[model samples]
Target: MKHLRFYFDVISPFAWLAFAKLPKVIEGHSVTVDYQPVLFAGLLSHWGQKGPAEIEPKRAWTFRHVYWQAHRDGVPLQTPAQHPFNPLALLRLAMACAPEGMTPGRHACEKIFRHVWEGGGDANDPARLQALTQALAPGRDPNSDAVKQALKASTDQAIARGVFGVPTVELDGRLFWGVDALDMVSASLRGDPWFDGPDWSRAAVAPPGVVRPPKGNP
Candidate 1:
């Protein structure tokens, strides 16, 4: 089994940031990264959660925060022209490229992310999508029934496995969400003695309040 399963949506700047940082995170480790594409809209619908882009300060903060992190990580940052465009075609294209090899899928993903997020391009444009698929997957067709079905199945599998957001890393039945979790992913890959750490519950103390909080919730 692959040590790291990364789920992403090209619509997410955080996912792009995480994807950019993955090369460094996986370096010097034997862990493998299995990149899987899922629709952010679908996950939000299934989990009854709102996307960051649909909210106020979060939507505004999302872009600013990720750009800061991208600069910090020496990764280029670009915003998309549309806030929440349909990703169906894009997801299918990525899955189509996947059959050829990881590189094709990965490069396709990077190109899409760069063009949409970095170049502020409209991802919903069919001509733009076809050009990417042609270059990345050769004869692959993104709008094909087969590609659409495959992406949907893969996305459903991600949702069933408790994936609720982009840039989620699944390992050993545990899920790590966001770029911040990459450190934990690395630690797990290295078999660190304190990877899971000790249960602090035994040495915990209650915090002041109208009513005391739960053991690890205070």
Candidate 2:
């Protein structure tokens, strides 16, 4: 079976928007997706990069772009007043629902995605997250023992993967960095260009390095 690896963080609006179409994309090509929750802060730290606070303009532009892209994808989304610093709890909740047997997991993820991206809800808020989860899984209460167990399992799985960012899709030991690259993932599942390098990196023969005359070439 085709496996599409997905990496994401709850705080990433772009990731939230991309999650909306994952199911549809997978079904379109009859493949399965493996979700990988990551820590955005940790990743940035590793890169020695100060967070978005260091670049307010860039952050604003990113949020705006995410909204526009979400619109293009027909996925409704909005920016939150503040992003959750840690979303492992939410990721665990998502993990519990993503497996084949529990269709509820998928529904729960969608609900949370909407809560974060559309309603501007804080994913780190247990009350809000649990509320959304309950709304989506009427039969299995988010506060139930079963759900707790599932959430724990999901969290464990995520930690095991060394996830440290949002929207990191991996396959064959290679990581695809963002939601915008889903088209490539979809193509892989379709048995086309599965191993081909990313579209952005494909080099069109860098027009033979040109050498100019010393000074006055008119």
The model with the greatest TM-score is 1
Estimate the TM-score for candidate 2: 0.66
Cα displacement (angstroms), candidate 1, residue 88, comes to: 1.5
Candidate 2 weakest ten by summed lDDT: 98-107
Candidate with the greatest lDDT versus the true structure: 1
TM-score of each: 0.83, 0.66
| Pairs in clash, predicted candidate 1 | 78-117, 78-118
In candidate 2, which residue ranges exceed 4 Å CA deviation?
A: 95-104, 122-126, 133-164, 193-218
Candidate lDDT values, in order: 0.77, 0.62
Clashing pairs in 2: 7-167, 7-168, 8-166, 8-167, 9-166, 38-165, 39-164, 39-165, 97-105
